[model samples]
Target: MEAALSLPATLVAKLIEDAERHGMSVDEYCRAILSESRAGDRSSAQAAVINEPSLDDLKLEQLSVERLSLTAVGRTFESGALSGHINRLLPLKIGCRVLWSLLSDEGVGPTIREFREEMWSRVGSLRDYLRMIDEDYARPRGDRLHASFPNSSDAAIKRFLNQYIIRKSGLNAEQSSGAMIDFGLIGISDTGRVQFTEVGRNFSLLSNPVLDEEDHRGPSLSADEQVLILSQIRTEMMREWKFMRHVLDGIHVGSNTPTSLLARINRRYGPGTKADWSASVMPHMRSGVLGRMQALGLVKRTFIENRVEYRVTPLALVILEADVV
Candidate 1:
């Protein structure tokens, strides 16, 4: 039987909201937190390093019914049912310790006006956004930034937003969430005022500032875009490196078996490594680095001694010359 849980009205609302946002029922979201906590207990390897429960995991656990119902369920649940439930939900910690972490780096919150300004700095005149939505205007293929459009807009905007933004700067819709007040990024009060969250401030700062102070003479792309472009290139290279490393490691050790490689990769990077990391490394590698390298003709598949292997092409020699690790 379900108990009448005496949780703060606001906390209950937040739980329901978060559960919906994740596309899970409140019950499912709650259970997932418990499941994650239990899994953590079984893995000593991860616990050795990240002794504290990650902020993300803790927040999710805070939404769980078992946790929220702890104090005031009024004997509805069995005696030991909620006894250790709260302890299980709390992340592993030696003591209440704070560290020099990224969470602390998110400085003071921005005002609503500052939030709007930051968005405007990236998106520029809403002319493009409005034109797409109101007039059904489509930016030409050549004008597309990163070959995509803004996400907050309709098909026309979605198709063109990334293209326009990246050509001007390498920032894309997924990174910036277009120019809208994303509820995920910022918080909204019951009275309908925008609240600057830590994440919201970080996201706002990601966009290039309005005035290009350093580069007096504006170049082909703004400094922010150039930095972003370089970062993107590096990220692309790293992904390739990981894929290459996975394959090269196997090949050098005389084990190019796909199943064996997958097993090794999964052990190193699967579920316990980080929150929301893929359980199967194959899917990410397949469509990402492998697909890109194949399209670029940097590697080719070959059959050698009754085993399938990927050999680096002559064109990829330059890449191999560098220290892969």
Candidate 2:
């Protein structure tokens, strides 16, 4: 004999009523309820079992030493890439996007979703607006649009618009009318198509808080100052020229300091100490002197063997060369 089924008549009646309301049969409703109960139970059990990190935890992890080191180097290179010239001015928009992308990606490849979400958080929907701008004024390329300003990825463009343009302009008005009009960044034609005026392009490029001239102060050091600094650097390098060269040539092909390699130099050139060398050079090198060289792309640092190692950059070779030998 079949086992007796159990269910309250009132509950069955209520289920039937709900099923009728939704136009589902009693059998269908029961199946759905059972499936839903199982799903809910699974979800609750999973919630209890898994110990997922919160956004804050993720953020903290992102800020750890390993992440920070990569971020620092990536940011340095990103800035270098955008500016092209070491001392050239970068608009606020460009700067913000560059920084946000670097931080979000944590020095890895670009994340378009994170960038898009960042844009949506700041502005409504950047896609349609960007498309409109591209259709009206920009020339389309392979996967990007070229406007009067530099060509960049959509995420890059959106971040630039959000942090630099919208925030700086303080445009919080309705999407179609107030902000764009008040800021004079966009216009609607009689046919209702968005048209970019010359003034709009000029404002976007020059007036946008992100890419304005204020942040970029051109070259920080003059040619004469550069010459003086390079002279000092060369003088210091000459003291250990043969030693450094030998170290460079013989060093293991990886991120490593010259110490192990410099053993060769010590053997050939005698016992010279980095501490003594630094002490001697530190007096002649003023504060911000190394920073100036970095800005000029003359030197860079690498982390190897849990320590920082400095080396001359490619640009330094051109700048530091003697006439012949």
Candidate 3:
């Protein structure tokens, strides 16, 4: 037997939104909420307020759907197969940039522009992006590392960090959107100074857990920095394919080729009956997801007798194993 509890319309809506973001059905979300409520002290009436929507909920309500897309995909990956590594990948490149800038400074964090400029210097040039791809992809399966980026300008980077990364990382908007504070990496003081967190330092310091030495793009980068960069690149790839998980899943190790993968993905997500997905979606996925996965040591891409073939790496098998478990 069950009883229906009355809930505010706004609260119900917020639950639905949260459910969607976490890739959970409404029933699952409600069950989790009820379980949490039961675990708390029932004597206190405050537990009931857990269902109440906050200002952030209101802001999300007003914002467009694209802004909130990251929230769902990031969490869904985290909750399932990528459980151990998902936290390291949120906000992808931008998150790593923020953490690294904070780590290098060791005191005051870099301003939004400073961080963006540094990242731009690394991968801004078309030559640089291509070189990174070559270094990352033209290697033994176990030696590849995550190395890719969306073409972006300083203003675009700044906007993405402030408007998207911050919110997606679970930081408040109104109080934390100032220059000094960002997603949990940096904090602001009363005098307007900024300092990074221990969490940020640790994140920036993660050693390369999967890739090999040949995969490291820069000799100057510390092991932790290399790992963080790879994490960011991997995260960026996942975020780009957020809407196309089906295509990713469809791409089996021995069964798909570059041409076939492109065809399969285009059939599903492309502008059907008119524009070629090969002209648009295929190029983006080739450069973004498949290229990055090959670089990350997650997947191996090889040219066999003039045809390209893909195989899952050992590290990727770990993720697949988790999915089954």
The runs of at least 3 residues in candidate 1 whose Cα sits more than 4 Å from the true structure, single-residue gaps closed, are 1-174, 177-232, 235-244, 247-257, 274-276, 303-308
CA lDDT scores, all candidates in order? 0.35, 0.36, 0.43
Q: How many residue pairs clash (N, CA or C atoms closer than 3 angstroms) in each of the candidate models, in the order given?
A: 13, 5, 1
Ranking by TM-score: 3, 1, 2
Off by over 4 Å in 3: 1-106, 118-200, 208-248, 253-255, 272-279
Clashing pairs in 2: 91-210, 91-211, 92-210, 92-211, 93-210
Model 1 poorest ten-residue lDDT run:
89-98
lDDT tens string, model 2, 29-104?
8899899999999999898656331122112122332322222110011110111111111222232333233342
lDDT of 1 by residue, 201-260 (tens): 332333221121222122213334333322333343354345445555553455445566
Predicted candidate 3 versus true structure: per-residue lDDT over 1-325, tens digit per residue: 6898889999989999999998999999989989888867664557546533221211212323222111101111221112111222323423444334343323444444455455455434422433455565563432322222234566654554443333213342224442113223444333333334443434433432222232334322344553454454245335333422443455554336767776665665566534334455455645445544543445556678977777776756665555431
Better of 1 and 2 by TM-score: 1
lDDT of 3: 0.43
Candidate achieving higher TM-score, 2 or 3: 3
